[model samples]
Target: MPRVEFGMKTESGEEFTINGELTDDELLTITNFVQSAEKLLECRLVQCGNFLPKKITWNQVSGFDICEVNEIDFEALFACLHLSRPFILQKEPWSYNSVSGILGRVFSHHSEVKRELKGLRKIYSDGALSYYFDISIQEKSIFDESRFLSWLNSYQYHRDQDKSVLYDELKSSFSENGAHHIMLIRLHGKLQAIEQLTHLCKVIIKSSAKQS
Candidate 1:
């Protein structure tokens, strides 16, 4: 049987061995093993050596040996998510703590919304990066019709007469120490724009999860 050997380093700086066979079934098994270990140890496993899939011994197995694990820093990971690209594409680590916090705030009432708004303002005030969501659509519907018109009106009111108004609005809206806002703006003035927005958000979130 074709055999493979891979090396990885745990978050705690422990090196380990991972061996498997060069087959689809074996690859899936190896990935599952690594994921399980990551969950159990509460740490990420990074590949330490190139994937070598042609050299294996009968005694080798498709799993890690001497796996080392370490604690995770979720806060730092979350902060990093907003620093580089759109929120969805940012490579940030995800942990139960961070996920819980996000869910709590998102599902909270108006009071929580206000609190988050304030927090966003603070983030912007601290000169954090911001993202503007632009939408595009192939077809239109009632929702798109209404939201797009509203956004257009708002944009015109803020920018048509003077560009400075737009800048002023951005500054005012994103004010407060540590307050950062991800602005969702109508791009093609269509509700179908949501499709693109959704796609972008997914991409960012997925990337962040993997990297974190």
Candidate 2:
């Protein structure tokens, strides 16, 4: 798929650029940006240690992960996404707390990643992150099992008792504050498709206005 480059300028003379492959849902979101009376885009960066998947399909990611070793730069990612939209960057620990959160959501079969988003709303004073992305997707996530299995494999918790007890701990840790590697990206912006794709979606947003 062809990559699209996006550029924008703020009323205050700031300039920003981003290039990536968009998913179908993302394209739809961007299209909505163009039609809606709202011109602002709410964007946020989901950074991780590893390179993000080259091609992300719509609704493909079940949830995001961030272990202790893979801390993302919240400041940088937030700035990039904030430029294009009314953005929010949820801050939490990227440690055992994150692991436990994922596990808690799994054991309860709840997929919203509440554990991952500890202190999210209080920080923003904006009700919740759902104002950006559909929190409902979590209830029906496709990668829940995968995330759970990945956690199990990470610690090599093979013994039955160890696994059982760990599950309980995860549920308990759901309410604690800790670091999380994953972040959410919810954008409301215009979509000018530079190119379409059979495998992946690619588009661009450019500004003819000069920087101040």
Candidate 1 similarity to native, TM-score: 0.15
Question: How big is the RMSD of model 1?
Answer: 23.8
> Candidate 1: lDDT over CA atoms?
0.29
Q: Which candidate number maximizes TM-score?
A: 2
lDDT of 2 by residue, 94-206 (tens): 12123223224332432232322343322222222334433222342212322233333333223344444333333333211111211221121111110111011112322
Query: lDDT of model 2 at residue 85?
Result: 29
**Window of ten residues with lowest summed lDDT in model 2:** 190-199
lDDT of 1 by residue, 120-176 (tens): 432322212213222222232212323322333344223343333333343343341
